[model samples]
Target: MDATSFILPLAEITIAGAIINASVHFVPVGGAPAAMATSTGVGTGTTQLAAGAGFTGLLAAATMASQAGVSLANPVHMLLIMLSGAVGAMIMLGLTMLIGQIIYVYGIGIVPAADKCEKDPITGDIQKPYITPGTTGHGIPTVCFVSGSIGAALGGLGGALAYIALQQLGFAAAIAGVLAVGFFFMNAVLASYNIGGTIEGFHDPKFKKMPNGVIASFVSSLIAGAVLIGMAMGL
Candidate 1:
């Protein structure tokens, strides 16, 4: 049946969440600069999602309003488009979450557990291995930030389309998706090179040896995209 009622809320929430994340990344929560001021940005891209989502939402709204002039069509038409948007947004969100999970649990997160010591020596086997930025390369955070933004855009745009579809018909939904994706795509290019050094404090002597941040981002995005596609089906 594709009811417009439930789908509207789902679409809005997903879009809003992504936008908020985008906003946070760019808005700079504290008085200081976002990433560079920090010890190291790591997964700091989550903060920026808010702004991206907000802008995307506004664009979607304008689109739906304009198309209203076209015709007073069937509610079912609106519902179907809304369903598509919902499906798309869910796909994007699921992907980002999956990537986030991977980053959190593996790579930077998978610190070796300190319980495998066998010999009962005087020093007690030092247990956990430390992760100094010195051990990693510059590309790690860079990759993560880039990947996160891609995931956010995919999710947010899907959400924006959902919003328009909920209110109106075909053209509006398409417009919403286009606007959201376009703005985000432009931003993606910029975020790729800039985020790592600024957010994760990549330049800090400690992280000087850390791995490249770019690879992490690319891989994360891949995992996220796959998961999002799976989620879209459910939506």
Candidate 2:
């Protein structure tokens, strides 16, 4: 009702939107230096597209919620607004998927003729559009293209859940609980990735990062669930 009440969540979502943009869509361009020491000679990885989807969804949902004057500061308010935001994100995600699918089905792939790569020197984390040696020169594949869309859809769901939940349990506690479970889940995912990658004979490993997704999902879902509980309690 009051401007302050209305503005806070909108502000939060806006901040979240910026975070999403950074995480999604802002990949390092494809090029050389993205070489892998694999048997495939030169190649590139499409992990950024995949990993950045949730962030993208987060932004998309936040943008929709904020623009539409949706707020989630409490259980009833959150419940009322969730469907709208989620639907918007889902639609956006679906469109991305459609575009990606079209590209994959029609074209062979997208190649970056030149060489350019970005990374975090300290962490060895990549920060650019992925350009693997195999895919780098030859270019990115259709499969890779469509998969990016898949990431967006999943991300939308995750973001919707996270923000909705955050409204109920309080942010700090929600994130903390999610982190505790996330650490363990991350280790498990890492172990699985290593075992799977090894058996598959691919360096496509990621036990460390997958847990982040798990945790984010856990936090968001938990928040959403809590809000639902509160609504029931109020009733």
- The global C-alpha lDDT for each of the candidates, from Candidate 1 onward, is 0.36, 0.36
Write one digit per residue (lDDT tens) for candidate 1, span 1-235: 3445435434443343333223223321111222222222233443344334434444544444445443225555444443443344334433443454455346445431112122112234332243333332211233234333444344344444434533332234454455345433433333333344333222223233223323333344334333333344354
Q: What is the lDDT of residue 32 in candidate 1?
A: 27
Model 1's lDDT to the true fold? 0.36
Can you tell me which runs of candidate 1 are displaced by over 4 Å?
Answer: 1-42, 46-72, 110-235
Instruction: Point out the worst 10-residue segment of candidate 1 by lDDT.
Output: 112-121
Model 2 shows how many backbone clashes? 18
Candidate 2 minimal-lDDT segment of 10 residues = 198-207
Clashes in predicted model 1:
47
**Which digits, one per residue and each the tens of the lDDT, describe model 2 over residues 20-127?**
322222222121332322211112223333233443444444554455555554555554444444445456544544453344335534432212224323244452
Error of 1 at 128 (Å): 19
lDDT of 2: 0.36
